[model samples]
Each structure stands twice: as structure tokens, then as C-alpha cells.
Target: MGTWGTSIKDNDAFADVYSEFFDFYNKGGQPEIISKKIIEDNWEILEIEEEKNSLWFALALAQWETKSLDPKIISKVEEIILSGVDLKIWLSLGASEQDIKKRKIALDKFLEKIKSDRPKAKPRKRKKLKTPIFATGDCLVFKLSNGNYGGAVVLATDNNPETAYNLVVTTRLNQSNKPTIKDFQNTEVLICNFGQWQDKADVTWYMPDLFYKDYADIYEKIGKISVDLEYDNKNHDGKGYLFKPSWTACWGMNNAADKQFESELTKPKPKKTLTIKQLTKKEKWWKVF
Candidate 1:
């Protein structure tokens, strides 16, 4: 005799419910009806033999009852699994014993493949900063030797610092007509005019009447001008203020000048006003009290 025959067991309501559910499903009845019947009968048998196949049947029934029920079940199952549980225990409660075994095997294979095929994430590379371009002959107004604002004229071409320095030296000698470099150094002439090198010449230079217009035109032909200030402060010990000519400032000044000039050109005239009077007739009646 088998052990099953020797042992005594109580047949519960779940047995009847399961049979009814299976019968309804086999008969192609609505799954929702079957699920409700099973729930009403209090069938708690989540794990049984052939659980996976049984679950498929149950889920199919659930869908027949309500299309979204099966998907809801799947979501719940995933959430429960991710929440943490012993794999063995989780498997035990599945539709059946065989399903539990198969799922465990599949899970192990998936984990092993993930471990073998995964690539290590590499660190991201930092981007390099771009050097800015500056133009030549830009006038830079700065404090000079005698507490007076002096403009440094840019004389170098657009090139590296060393090349610009050489150009400045050559241009200075040519301008002074001095053959000796020492004679050129004694004059308050600054080399490369670093202070003014980056500053852009005011657009007023293009206008007809500016005093420096001719000099500005000559400077433009020389090279790209820029202020000599350190462009990139990455190596600087601390932050420092740098002066640069702003187009906004220049535009504002130009607007102000334009307004002043317009005011002088056209004075405000007094507004003339005219007045007129009209007469109308009316009748009044008095009542005696």
C-alpha cells in the first residue's frame, strides 16, 4: 500500500472549490466566475503539484473574469518577489511543485548569465576648455604712470604670446625709427600692450569724426587685438578682477550721446491751446407752497 493510503487526511472545502474551478475552466466557462467561486469557497491552495500549469489555467480564468486581473496578479507577484523572500519558500507557494523546481532552475541560469556577461561601467571623460579668440587694435583705457587714463594701442598680429611679443617689439622699433632696441625700451612704450591686447576698439572708430579714427584703422590692419589679461584662471592662486570692454557699456554711451545730440538739435516748443464758449436757453417754473 502506498503511504498516501496509510495516512489519514481531512478533505477540506478547498478540494471542492478547486474541483469546481477546474471543471468550469475545462468547460470554457468565464474565468472570473471560477475565481469568484473559488474565493467564495475559501480555497487557499496556492501551491499544489503542477502549480505552473494550474496557475496558467487560473490566470486564464482570471482573464476570462476580467482582462486586467492576470496582469494585476503578475505585478503583485513581481513586487512580492522583489520585496525579499527565501527562494525556496517563494517557489513552494507557486501553482505546483514541478513549477517551483522549473522556476528555480531558470532563475539560477539567469543569475549566472548576468554575472558572466556584464561589463564594468567606465568613468566619464572630462571635456577640454576652448581658448577664446581676440581681435587687434582694440583700445583699452587703463590707469597709467601719472594717474591719467592712457590708451594702449595693440601692435601685434593674432598669434601665440611669444609671436605677439616679437611683433610688438619690431613694430615699436619701426615706429620710433630707432635702430637700437635699448633706445626703444626707455620710452613709456609697453610691449605687446597686454593691457589693451584683448580690448576691442570702440565701434565709434568707424564713424567719421572720432579723433583716433585714423589710428584705429591702422591698428585693425596690424592684427587681432585683445587685453593681455590671463584668459584662463585655472592656475591662478585666487580670483582676481579683470577689466574688459563691454558692448553693452559702449551701446549705452552711444545712446546717451545720441539723445543729447537730438535734444540740442530739436528744442521742445510750447503746445498751443484754443478755448470756445456756447449759450443755451432754459425755462424754470416756481410752485407756491
Candidate 2:
């Protein structure tokens, strides 16, 4: 838990940084020259705010502290800080509706000042949006270790499942070369559905690379694998895949999803048995010899 006094101190530390930047700007010094060093020093300090509260204030502080050392920069920083203060006041202590209204008015004035002085650039044209390759309510293919394959239906909405989605599949061979889809043999494919809010839907896949060691291995082989999928969205035709054993896939979310899948995998499997009469019938057939 953090105290109110700590928040005040953090706020003051940010203010001091803003003051120093303002001083430099007023002196007609170049702020961009020291921007990198200043940012490195303040990164941890920024984390303090990021952990304790909203990142909006921290971003404003960063913008102020790193703005070009010029008169305009100082003015922009002050405007941003004032706007942040207004936002904090509104979110912190309970204020009367009238007080909220008044704060918003002041905040609007500060924003107007910022807009008047800020540099303008050409507006970017919007690109056409494509239907996501992976989406919610779609069946996904995954490889297992026994020279075989498995699949699951994607339950959560995935606006960008290829990059943002997390998943958990049952198999071994953390490395790509060791266990290809051919390794998954005689293993039952267990499919589980998870909602967007479910914790299990958040696992990410990790891969190995010589240069970038932190990368996750999402794709295993060069060739594509084909699989069937069912989609909730109506516009796109639902089922298709490119080739055999498409790529190494992993859940994109947190470890919680992995744990959930493991629990599901651990459930008892039903056993097969033969009755005595059936056994006797087989014996009778052998007795003819």
C-alpha cells in the first residue's frame, strides 16, 4: 500500500524535473541534446507512477521533462501538467459535481493553450482493415509430441490473435527441431473453450533464436498445415488451412492459461473392459481346435 504523502512526493519530484526543463528552455538551450540521458534516469521514477496510478500523468511528466529546451517547450509542459492536475483532482478525492465541472473548465482552457502552440502535421490516411486471420469462435490447430496433431476451438474474441493472443496446448519439445508435428502419435486432442475474460485465454508462446534469445517459437516448420475452423463473425467464410503442420503455435497470454489447460489434461480417462460372456465366446471359438 502507498500513502497519500508518497503520492505528493512523487508529484513534487516530477514537478522539479519540469522546473529544470523549463529553466533550460528559458535559457535557450537544446533539450533534445540531453533527452536520452534524462529519459534513462527518469524511467524508474516513471514506473513509480505507472504502478501506483494511471500512466497518463507519467506520460505528461515525460513529455514535459524531455521537450525541446525552448520557450515553447516550457509553455507546453506547464499546460500538460495543469491538465494532469485537473484530471488527478477529479479522480482522487471525491469532489462535488460543481467542483468537477469547474475543474473540467480549467482543464479545457489548458488544453486549448497546448493546441494553440503545438506543431501541426499532415493527417495520416486510414488503411483498409482486413478480417483477422485468427478470431474468436474459431477452431485452431496445434501440434503434439507423439508424431501427431491436435486442435481446439478459440472461444475468446481475438481482434489480433496472431500477435496478441495467448494459448496453451498439450505437447513437449520446447525447441522446434526436436519434436515436429510428426512426434504427436496416439495422443488424444483435447479441446477447451475459454471466454475473453477467462484467465486461461492469456498464455503466450515462446520460441528460441540464436540472436534474439527472448523470442518465442510460434512457427516451427517452413511448410503450412491445413485445419478446419468455425467462426462467429458472419462475413468471412469459416473453414480452411494452407498446408500440413502449419507452424509451431503457443498461447499468447499469461501462464494462467497454461495451468488451466494442464488441469483439463489431467482429468481421468475412461477405461475399456470385456465382459466374462464375451471372453467365453472367444474361448469357445479357440476350443474347436
Candidate 3:
């Protein structure tokens, strides 16, 4: 309720949402329940039209101020982040998914930017986007520690009590150094926020050429590599924005249209047609078709 206090002036709807948020913040609101209410019930009443996900940021800031960065709150905030780009300015200023203290500092800068850059009237265009969070089934463009870029697909996610969430990913290990769209197979990886087992994960791989022959050897050489990557604007260039190694990067959920393309990419490609020589090798080749 710091800067939000100023904006609530003459806006009863904003005040109502603010009031309800603090009530839940202090009285222990069910994260999932309250989140559903915000999306379904209070969406219009919140009076945050220009920035759709601003209320989540408001609540996130409130939680930060109140020293309540629990998994419940974090998970709910993450849902809002996945839905849209309302928090672009904040994330672009380096607001992170790690420590509350660091995020508080980043949020301070974000609020200041909002105050200073508050337009007297609405602008024609929206702000530019920052790095996006990769959701399940979405294609990933990753830059390795060796300065090489690789393509991957987020297979699925699971809730782990120890780690915030686990990501099962299919990767093209030993693929081209340059980033390109290719069928990923032969390797699977799991990503998590943090834990004893998860913390030891070496995201970077030992090239499976000469040095590494088996999974054990590759696992042995697993170095602590940064997982947060910038949104690859469909460019496949190796350029990507970097985040603090400690902060868990946020991701944007793919919309239906985006999901369609991803599904196509994940589907098995048709096999090549048999050559004339191979066809002639079999006496009953014509029946094979």
C-alpha cells in the first residue's frame, strides 16, 4: 500500500481491492482461492485496465512489505506473470524471483519509474516486453556457458514440495552451436528452483563427442550454469538478456495460437520416401506401399 495509496485517490474500486488484499495478507488468505477471486470476481472492480496484471504486482509488493514471500504467495504471483506482460517495466528493471530483499530493491526502482513515467494520458502503444518465462510445451532458446545457443522444448512440469516446480525438458544435446529450430531428442533434463539434489544440477553438458560417453560422465561434468534466458524474439540469434543467476526467471504462458505451432513442432515428421534402388531390392516392394 505504499505507492498504491496515492493511486487509490478518487478510485473506490482500487481502494476496495487494496482493502481486500491487505485483509487477506494479514489474515492469511488461501493463495489459490484468493487468486481465483481476483481473476474472476475482482478483475473489473480492481480498476486496473491498462495494465492487466498490475493487481498481482500490487499484491506481490504488499507481500514483500509484510515479509510474507511464502510459496503460496509466490505461486499465485507467478500465475499472474504467466498470463500477460503487465509487469514488464518491473522485470525489465531486474525484479527477480529469488530473495524478497533483492526484489524489494528492484520494486523500489520500478515504482519510481512508474511515478516518473506516468503519462498524463494513455499512450497509443504499450511498453516493450522483457524476457519471457517458458511454459510447458513451449520451445526454449538457451545460451550455454560455452557461449553456444541450443533449442529445447519444455515437456512438462510437476509440483515438488522441496523445489518450487520441476521442468522436464527435451534437448538437442551436441546440436549445432548456433540457435536453430530442430527436432530435439536423445536427452531429457529437469529444472527446479532449488534443493540439495536440484542445486547440484549442472545445466551445461559435457559434449558427447570425445570426453563424455555415458550419462554418468556428462552428469559428473555438470557445471552450475545460469538457467534464466531472454525471450528469443523468433530471431535464433545468440543474443539474449541475462538475469541474476540466483533469481528464478519468470515465463509467459503460450496462448492457443502459439501452442498450435509448438504442437506441430513436437509431432513426428514423415519418413523420407524409399529410393528406386531400395525399392528394386525387394521382390514385393510394390505391395509394401
- Residues 1-289, candidate 1, lDDT per residue (tens digit)? 0000000110112123333554565565566666666655443345433222233333433333334344554444444334433244434332135434554554444333322422332222233232212233333332221232323333223243311111121111122121232322232332121111222221111111111321222222222233343222222222342122111101111212222222323543212211100000112335322
lDDT of 3 by residue, 99-149 (tens): 234434444554443334232422222322222122434455544323444
lDDT value, candidate 3, whole model: 0.33
What clash count goes with each model?
A: 15, 37, 3
Candidate 2 per-residue lDDT over residues 1-289, each given as its tens digit: 1111122122323333443443444455455654444456556555653222222333343344343234454455456456465446444543346546655665455445434534542232233332333433233343433233333333223354223322223322223333323333222322223212122112122111111221124223322222233223222222231111111121322222232343345543223222212211224556778
- How do all the candidates rank in terms of lDDT, highest first? 2, 3, 1
TM-score on alpha carbons, each prediction:
0.21, 0.25, 0.26
TM-score of 1: 0.21
| Model 2 residue 153 distance off true place after TM-score fit, in angstroms | 68
Error of 1 at 238 (Å): 94
Estimate the TM-score for candidate 2: 0.25
Model 2 ranges with Cα > 4 A deviation? 1-14, 26-28, 50-89, 92-99, 118-289
Which one wins by lDDT: 1 or 3? 3
